[model samples]
Target: METTREGAKKIAHDSTVQSLNQLLEKNYDAENGYKNALTETKSAQLKPYFTKQAARRSRNANELYKAIRNLNATPVEKGSAKAAVHRTWLDLKTAVVGKNDESILKECTRGDITAVNEYEKVLNDPEYLLDSKGMIRQQLHNIQISLKTIRKLKDIVD
Candidate 1:
């Protein structure tokens, strides 16, 4: 059964990686097309907006990552635990939003940092078990991994 589960996990990871690559490729094409259009246009005023919009698209991608983390990190139990997770999620979401609006990568980094912090909180809580929250925390970890790669890519681009 463990082998079977491991096989399934491998298949799932492969599929997700393939899909993510496709999405990134599409985004690259779209960004290039927009930049090309910006280049040909006579108006200089519109270029900044396009540049900002592209940045916003990247920011939105990070926001989506946070949302995924929040969804996965939601406590299974209600009451105080639920409230706590919800509050932490809100704080993380707010940080992402505020950072994105300002076009700052720090916001996304902070969001990831907040997520790790909240995950640690869940780990420390007696109500939540490590095993029970394993999958959810793993999903949250994916966001962290993706954000790290995104930051690296951004650095290369800049």
Candidate 2:
């Protein structure tokens, strides 16, 4: 029974680490995506907002890295390849259609939505990790606010 409990704990820890790494990748992607949007968008008014978002995401990524390391797991250093592809697509779309504020905000909103979903998944997972839950929820709330801000900005642009 003791060995079984230990093994179960180990499995939970491993699962939590995996989820954290995935969230870290998401933060990285969001950070880079915001930077890209900052450079490519013609909306001067949104530049500062984009910069803030990039910084926020970078901070989030660092937090996630620390959490994974604390759990004795390797942290993912960069965004996922799928995110890279999405960034590439955004660039191409901007180049082809020209820089539109609505479109840029739309993409940002999408990225935030993805982050929110991932955070929610981890928070609701079966790991029973209360410590991890608080951290994830804090970040999740921030991302939710970001989504709201993006939507309001897009509405203003429209």
Candidate 3:
């Protein structure tokens, strides 16, 4: 029979894995969001920015995947199905409204906010492992940077 301590540890580990997977999904969504923005936006100035953001998000996902593997959990290989549906909605909205740079920036900012929230949840959870905190902090920092950039772009558009 599992001891109480062992059971507690198992629960903590499971919670940590679930949080990490959530972050990974957000990263995947951000990557796809930036890619779509890059392809859809006609602004030469914004294309390079979106390209860089996409690459950053891909890197973030890789980092999260490694962290999840280190915890002996299998990371999610793709973004959430909800995110996919949201992307489809974004595409339809863009097609109907015209691919305005401001609108694209707004969408990207929303994605960043989602990522930031996921990371914050993991960071704030007392059950999360200490070793993983550093990695989560780093990922959060990167997401914040991207958010700031997106906001700056939005300001420019405004």
Candidate 4:
């Protein structure tokens, strides 16, 4: 016997958790994507950067996991299938396009852009809880910083 207000509250909270799970999935994708980049990256300079990015993604995923768990939802512990397909496409593109650090940088940047958009989507939703909003903002900020880092790396080599 839930009142209308209580029902609305539950709906909002559930949506917030759902949003967090979506973000978590992307973080997992980013983590694995970076790992794959590391294996394909030949540049000595880029390998360390890729490794650091992968670690950051993992940390981001952990935060999302805890956040979702706090809301009593089972946080998704696996990467999205879209990520594997994206990687495969990138691999094929690399064969015809460029295999150099420049090309890899482009691909990584694209992935980061996708991650940023996903975060932005949740941020734009008014239904999301405020506490989780703070965490999402921080993650989005970190992703932006990584984008800048990639730009700087490009400058050094170009």
Using TM-score, give the best candidate's number: 3
Q: How accurate is candidate 3 locally (lDDT)?
A: 0.89
Indicate the worst ten consecutive residues by lDDT in candidate 2.
127-136
Would you list the clashing residue pairs of candidate 4?
A: none
lDDT of 4: 0.89
Quote the positional error of residue 109 for candidate 4 in Å.
0.8
Tens-digit per-residue lDDT, 82-101, candidate 1: 33464456457755763222
| lDDT for model 2 | 0.88
lDDT tens per residue, model 4, 1-158: 99999998898899899999999999999899889889988889989999999999999999999999899889987988888887888788878976777777877888888888889999999888888888899999999999989988888766
Please, what are the lDDT tens digits per residue for candidate 2 over residues 17-67?
A: 889999999999999999998887777789999999999999999999998
Report lDDT (Cα) of residue 94, candidate 3.
68
Runs with alpha carbons beyond 4 Å of true place in candidate 3: none
Worst 10 residues of 3 by lDDT: 90-99
Q: What is the C-alpha lDDT of each candidate?
A: 0.43, 0.88, 0.89, 0.89
Off-target runs (Cα >4 Å) in candidate 4 are 95-98
Best to worst by TM-score, what's the order?
Answer: 3, 2, 4, 1
Q: For each candidate, how many residue pairs have backbone atoms clashing (under 3 Å)?
A: 0, 0, 0, 0
lDDT of 3 by residue, 1-158 (tens): 99999998998999999998998888898899999999888889899999998998899899889989998899999999998998898778766878788888988988889788878988999988787889889889988988998888888888
CA shift at 104, candidate 2, in angstroms? 0.2
State in Å the error of residue 16, model 3. 0.9
